[model samples]
Target: MAIITVMVFILIGIFELTPLIKKGDIKGFAINLALLLCSCTVLTLKSLQISVPSPLKPIENLIKAIIE
Candidate 1:
Protein backbone atom coordinates (compact mmCIF):
# COMPACT_ATOMS: atom_id res chain seq x y z
CA MET A 1 0.00 0.00 0.00
CA ALA A 2 2.76 2.42 0.96
CA ILE A 3 4.73 1.62 -2.16
CA ILE A 4 1.65 2.08 -4.29
CA THR A 5 0.94 5.48 -2.78
CA VAL A 6 4.51 6.65 -3.27
CA MET A 7 4.53 5.52 -6.87
CA VAL A 8 1.28 7.33 -7.55
CA PHE A 9 2.56 10.54 -5.96
CA ILE A 10 5.83 10.35 -7.85
CA LEU A 11 4.03 9.93 -11.16
CA ILE A 12 1.72 12.83 -10.42
CA GLY A 13 4.61 15.00 -9.29
CA ILE A 14 6.57 14.31 -12.43
CA PHE A 15 3.62 15.35 -14.55
CA GLU A 16 2.82 18.47 -12.54
CA LEU A 17 6.39 19.58 -11.94
CA THR A 18 7.65 19.12 -15.47
CA PRO A 19 7.52 22.84 -16.17
CA LEU A 20 9.53 23.85 -13.12
CA ILE A 21 11.98 21.02 -13.69
CA LYS A 22 12.48 21.97 -17.32
CA LYS A 23 13.36 25.54 -16.33
CA GLY A 24 16.46 24.30 -14.44
CA ASP A 25 14.83 24.45 -10.97
CA ILE A 26 16.17 21.14 -9.85
CA LYS A 27 15.98 22.05 -6.16
CA GLY A 28 12.26 22.78 -6.30
CA PHE A 29 11.63 19.57 -8.16
CA ALA A 30 13.59 17.54 -5.65
CA ILE A 31 11.86 19.15 -2.68
CA ASN A 32 8.40 18.66 -4.12
CA LEU A 33 9.13 15.05 -5.00
CA ALA A 34 10.46 14.35 -1.52
CA LEU A 35 7.44 15.94 0.12
CA LEU A 36 5.06 14.04 -2.11
CA LEU A 37 6.75 10.73 -1.35
CA CYS A 38 6.76 11.40 2.38
CA SER A 39 3.11 12.40 2.44
CA CYS A 40 2.07 9.29 0.53
CA THR A 41 4.09 7.06 2.83
CA VAL A 42 2.50 8.51 5.93
CA LEU A 43 -1.00 8.30 4.52
CA THR A 44 -0.48 4.71 3.35
CA LEU A 45 0.79 3.68 6.74
CA LYS A 46 -2.17 5.31 8.40
CA SER A 47 -4.46 3.36 6.09
CA LEU A 48 -2.91 -0.02 6.89
CA GLN A 49 -4.71 -0.53 10.18
CA ILE A 50 -7.88 -2.67 9.90
CA SER A 51 -9.82 -0.82 12.60
CA VAL A 52 -9.72 2.63 11.12
CA PRO A 53 -13.09 4.13 10.35
CA SER A 54 -14.25 4.07 6.79
CA PRO A 55 -14.63 7.66 5.61
CA LEU A 56 -17.90 6.96 3.84
CA LYS A 57 -19.53 5.20 6.76
CA PRO A 58 -20.58 8.38 8.45
CA ILE A 59 -22.01 9.78 5.27
CA GLU A 60 -23.90 6.58 4.69
CA ASN A 61 -25.29 6.66 8.21
CA LEU A 62 -26.42 10.24 7.73
CA ILE A 63 -28.19 9.37 4.50
CA LYS A 64 -29.85 6.35 6.06
CA ALA A 65 -31.06 8.42 8.98
CA ILE A 66 -32.55 10.97 6.63
CA ILE A 67 -34.26 8.27 4.57
CA GLU A 68 -35.74 6.48 7.58
Candidate 2:
Protein backbone atom coordinates (compact mmCIF):
# COMPACT_ATOMS: atom_id res chain seq x y z
CA MET A 1 0.00 0.00 0.00
CA ALA A 2 2.81 2.43 0.80
CA ILE A 3 4.49 1.51 -2.45
CA ILE A 4 1.26 2.12 -4.29
CA THR A 5 0.89 5.53 -2.67
CA VAL A 6 4.47 6.44 -3.59
CA MET A 7 4.01 5.44 -7.17
CA VAL A 8 0.80 7.40 -7.37
CA PHE A 9 2.49 10.43 -5.89
CA ILE A 10 5.33 10.07 -8.35
CA LEU A 11 2.93 10.06 -11.25
CA ILE A 12 1.15 13.06 -9.78
CA GLY A 13 4.43 14.98 -9.42
CA ILE A 14 5.47 14.15 -12.92
CA PHE A 15 2.22 15.51 -14.26
CA GLU A 16 1.44 18.35 -11.88
CA LEU A 17 4.85 19.59 -10.77
CA THR A 18 6.51 19.48 -14.17
CA PRO A 19 4.51 22.49 -15.25
CA LEU A 20 5.59 24.51 -12.24
CA ILE A 21 9.22 23.75 -12.91
CA LYS A 22 8.99 24.40 -16.62
CA LYS A 23 7.42 27.79 -15.96
CA GLY A 24 10.21 28.64 -13.50
CA ASP A 25 7.76 29.11 -10.64
CA ILE A 26 10.04 28.11 -7.80
CA LYS A 27 7.63 29.19 -5.06
CA GLY A 28 4.78 27.24 -6.56
CA PHE A 29 7.04 24.29 -7.07
CA ALA A 30 8.17 24.36 -3.45
CA ILE A 31 4.65 24.66 -2.07
CA ASN A 32 3.31 21.84 -4.22
CA LEU A 33 6.25 19.59 -3.37
CA ALA A 34 5.81 20.24 0.36
CA LEU A 35 2.14 19.37 0.18
CA LEU A 36 2.86 16.23 -1.80
CA LEU A 37 5.59 15.09 0.57
CA CYS A 38 3.48 15.68 3.69
CA SER A 39 0.51 13.78 2.28
CA CYS A 40 2.71 10.95 1.12
CA THR A 41 4.40 10.66 4.51
CA VAL A 42 1.06 10.61 6.34
CA LEU A 43 -0.52 8.07 4.03
CA THR A 44 2.55 5.90 4.11
CA LEU A 45 2.63 5.99 7.89
CA LYS A 46 -1.07 5.15 8.05
CA SER A 47 -0.66 2.20 5.68
CA LEU A 48 2.23 0.88 7.74
CA GLN A 49 0.18 1.01 10.95
CA ILE A 50 2.75 3.25 12.61
CA SER A 51 1.20 5.32 15.35
CA VAL A 52 1.38 9.08 14.90
CA PRO A 53 0.38 11.11 17.91
CA SER A 54 -2.39 13.62 17.49
CA PRO A 55 -1.15 17.12 16.61
CA LEU A 56 -3.65 18.69 18.97
CA LYS A 57 -2.46 16.85 22.07
CA PRO A 58 0.10 19.50 22.99
CA ILE A 59 -2.44 22.26 22.57
CA GLU A 60 -4.91 20.36 24.73
CA ASN A 61 -2.29 19.89 27.43
CA LEU A 62 -1.37 23.54 27.29
CA ILE A 63 -4.99 24.59 27.67
CA LYS A 64 -5.50 22.24 30.59
CA ALA A 65 -2.39 23.53 32.28
CA ILE A 66 -3.49 27.08 31.78
CA ILE A 67 -6.93 26.40 33.23
CA GLU A 68 -5.53 24.67 36.24
Candidate 3:
Protein backbone atom coordinates (compact mmCIF):
# COMPACT_ATOMS: atom_id res chain seq x y z
CA MET A 1 0.00 0.00 0.00
CA ALA A 2 2.76 2.40 0.91
CA ILE A 3 4.57 1.54 -2.27
CA ILE A 4 1.44 2.14 -4.27
CA THR A 5 0.90 5.47 -2.61
CA VAL A 6 4.45 6.53 -3.38
CA MET A 7 4.18 5.38 -6.95
CA VAL A 8 1.06 7.44 -7.45
CA PHE A 9 2.67 10.52 -5.98
CA ILE A 10 5.76 9.96 -8.08
CA LEU A 11 3.64 9.85 -11.20
CA ILE A 12 1.87 13.01 -10.09
CA GLY A 13 5.16 14.78 -9.56
CA ILE A 14 6.48 13.67 -12.91
CA PHE A 15 3.41 14.78 -14.82
CA GLU A 16 2.15 17.77 -12.85
CA LEU A 17 5.34 19.17 -11.43
CA THR A 18 7.28 18.79 -14.66
CA PRO A 19 5.42 21.60 -16.35
CA LEU A 20 5.80 23.92 -13.37
CA ILE A 21 9.52 23.21 -13.19
CA LYS A 22 10.00 23.63 -16.92
CA LYS A 23 8.22 26.98 -16.72
CA GLY A 24 10.75 28.05 -14.06
CA ASP A 25 8.00 28.68 -11.53
CA ILE A 26 10.10 27.98 -8.52
CA LYS A 27 7.56 29.24 -6.02
CA GLY A 28 4.71 27.27 -7.54
CA PHE A 29 6.79 24.16 -7.84
CA ALA A 30 7.94 24.45 -4.24
CA ILE A 31 4.45 24.98 -2.90
CA ASN A 32 2.96 22.17 -4.99
CA LEU A 33 5.73 19.82 -4.01
CA ALA A 34 5.33 20.68 -0.36
CA LEU A 35 1.61 20.05 -0.40
CA LEU A 36 2.02 16.87 -2.42
CA LEU A 37 4.69 15.58 -0.07
CA CYS A 38 2.63 16.34 3.01
CA SER A 39 -0.39 14.54 1.63
CA CYS A 40 1.71 11.69 0.35
CA THR A 41 3.34 11.21 3.74
CA VAL A 42 0.01 11.25 5.50
CA LEU A 43 -1.47 8.75 3.09
CA THR A 44 1.53 6.50 3.32
CA LEU A 45 1.43 6.52 7.10
CA LYS A 46 -2.26 5.73 7.08
CA SER A 47 -1.63 2.86 4.69
CA LEU A 48 0.95 1.58 7.14
CA GLN A 49 -1.71 1.56 9.87
CA ILE A 50 -0.25 4.50 11.73
CA SER A 51 -2.47 6.84 13.66
CA VAL A 52 -2.59 10.34 12.27
CA PRO A 53 -4.29 13.03 14.32
CA SER A 54 -7.24 14.72 12.72
CA PRO A 55 -6.41 18.18 11.43
CA LEU A 56 -9.72 19.53 12.69
CA LYS A 57 -8.82 18.67 16.28
CA PRO A 58 -6.87 21.86 16.82
CA ILE A 59 -9.56 24.00 15.31
CA GLU A 60 -12.14 22.30 17.50
CA ASN A 61 -10.02 22.92 20.56
CA LEU A 62 -9.57 26.56 19.62
CA ILE A 63 -13.30 26.97 19.20
CA LYS A 64 -13.96 25.42 22.59
CA ALA A 65 -11.43 27.68 24.19
CA ILE A 66 -13.05 30.74 22.62
CA ILE A 67 -16.47 29.64 23.82
CA GLU A 68 -15.21 29.19 27.33
Candidate 4:
Protein backbone atom coordinates (compact mmCIF):
# COMPACT_ATOMS: atom_id res chain seq x y z
CA MET A 1 0.00 0.00 0.00
CA ALA A 2 2.75 2.42 0.91
CA ILE A 3 4.68 1.58 -2.24
CA ILE A 4 1.60 2.03 -4.40
CA THR A 5 0.83 5.38 -2.79
CA VAL A 6 4.39 6.59 -3.30
CA MET A 7 4.44 5.36 -6.91
CA VAL A 8 1.25 7.27 -7.67
CA PHE A 9 2.78 10.41 -6.22
CA ILE A 10 5.96 9.82 -8.21
CA LEU A 11 3.95 9.50 -11.44
CA ILE A 12 2.01 12.64 -10.62
CA GLY A 13 5.23 14.48 -9.91
CA ILE A 14 6.72 13.37 -13.22
CA PHE A 15 3.67 14.53 -15.13
CA GLU A 16 3.76 17.86 -13.31
CA LEU A 17 7.45 18.42 -13.88
CA THR A 18 7.64 17.41 -17.56
CA PRO A 19 5.96 20.54 -18.85
CA LEU A 20 8.04 22.79 -16.62
CA ILE A 21 11.18 21.02 -17.75
CA LYS A 22 10.23 21.37 -21.41
CA LYS A 23 9.68 25.08 -20.92
CA GLY A 24 13.04 25.38 -19.13
CA ASP A 25 11.33 26.93 -16.11
CA ILE A 26 13.68 26.06 -13.30
CA LYS A 27 11.84 28.08 -10.67
CA GLY A 28 8.48 26.50 -11.45
CA PHE A 29 10.02 23.06 -11.44
CA ALA A 30 11.66 23.67 -8.08
CA ILE A 31 8.48 24.98 -6.47
CA ASN A 32 6.42 22.13 -7.88
CA LEU A 33 8.96 19.59 -6.76
CA ALA A 34 8.96 20.98 -3.24
CA LEU A 35 5.19 20.86 -3.06
CA LEU A 36 5.13 17.36 -4.51
CA LEU A 37 7.67 16.17 -1.97
CA CYS A 38 5.78 17.67 0.94
CA SER A 39 2.44 16.25 -0.15
CA CYS A 40 3.95 12.89 -0.95
CA THR A 41 5.57 12.69 2.46
CA VAL A 42 2.34 13.59 4.19
CA LEU A 43 0.31 11.10 2.21
CA THR A 44 2.90 8.39 2.68
CA LEU A 45 2.90 8.96 6.43
CA LYS A 46 -0.89 8.83 6.46
CA SER A 47 -0.84 5.56 4.55
CA LEU A 48 1.42 4.14 7.21
CA GLN A 49 -1.19 5.15 9.86
CA ILE A 50 0.72 8.06 11.26
CA SER A 51 -1.08 10.98 12.83
CA VAL A 52 -0.63 14.30 11.07
CA PRO A 53 -1.16 17.54 12.92
CA SER A 54 -3.23 20.35 11.47
CA PRO A 55 -1.16 23.47 10.74
CA LEU A 56 -4.36 25.45 10.44
CA LYS A 57 -5.12 25.26 14.16
CA PRO A 58 -2.90 28.17 15.07
CA ILE A 59 -4.18 30.26 12.21
CA GLU A 60 -7.75 29.44 13.14
CA ASN A 61 -7.12 30.47 16.74
CA LEU A 62 -5.56 33.74 15.62
CA ILE A 63 -8.54 34.51 13.43
CA LYS A 64 -10.98 33.73 16.24
CA ALA A 65 -9.07 35.94 18.66
CA ILE A 66 -9.08 38.84 16.20
CA ILE A 67 -12.78 38.45 15.55
CA GLU A 68 -13.80 38.04 19.16
Tens digits of per-residue lDDT for model 4, 2-38? 7998999889988899999999999999999999899
Candidate 4: give the clashing pairs. none
Error of 1 at 10 (Å): 3.4
RMSD of 4: 1.9
The stretch of ten residues in a row with the least summed lDDT in candidate 1 is 45-54
lDDT of 2 by residue, 38-63 (tens): 98998889888888788999999999
In candidate 2, stretches whose alpha carbon ends up further than 4 angstroms from where it belongs are none
Task: Write candidate 1's Cα lDDT for 1-35 as tens digits.
Answer: 75677678778887978987899898987888778
What lDDT tens digits, residue by residue, belong to model 3 across residues 3-38?
A: 999999999999999999899999999999999999
| Alpha-carbon shift of residue 9 in model 2 (angstroms) | 1.3
Determine which window of 10 residues in candidate 4 has minimal summed lDDT. Answer: 1-10
What TM-score would you give candidate 4 relative to the actual structure?
0.80
Q: Which stretches of candidate 3 lie over 4 Å from their true place?
A: none
Prediction-by-prediction clash tally: 0, 0, 0, 0
Model 4, which residues run further than 4 Å from truth?
A: 60-68
Off by over 4 Å in 1: 1-8, 50-68
Tell me each candidate's TM-score: 0.51, 0.86, 0.89, 0.80
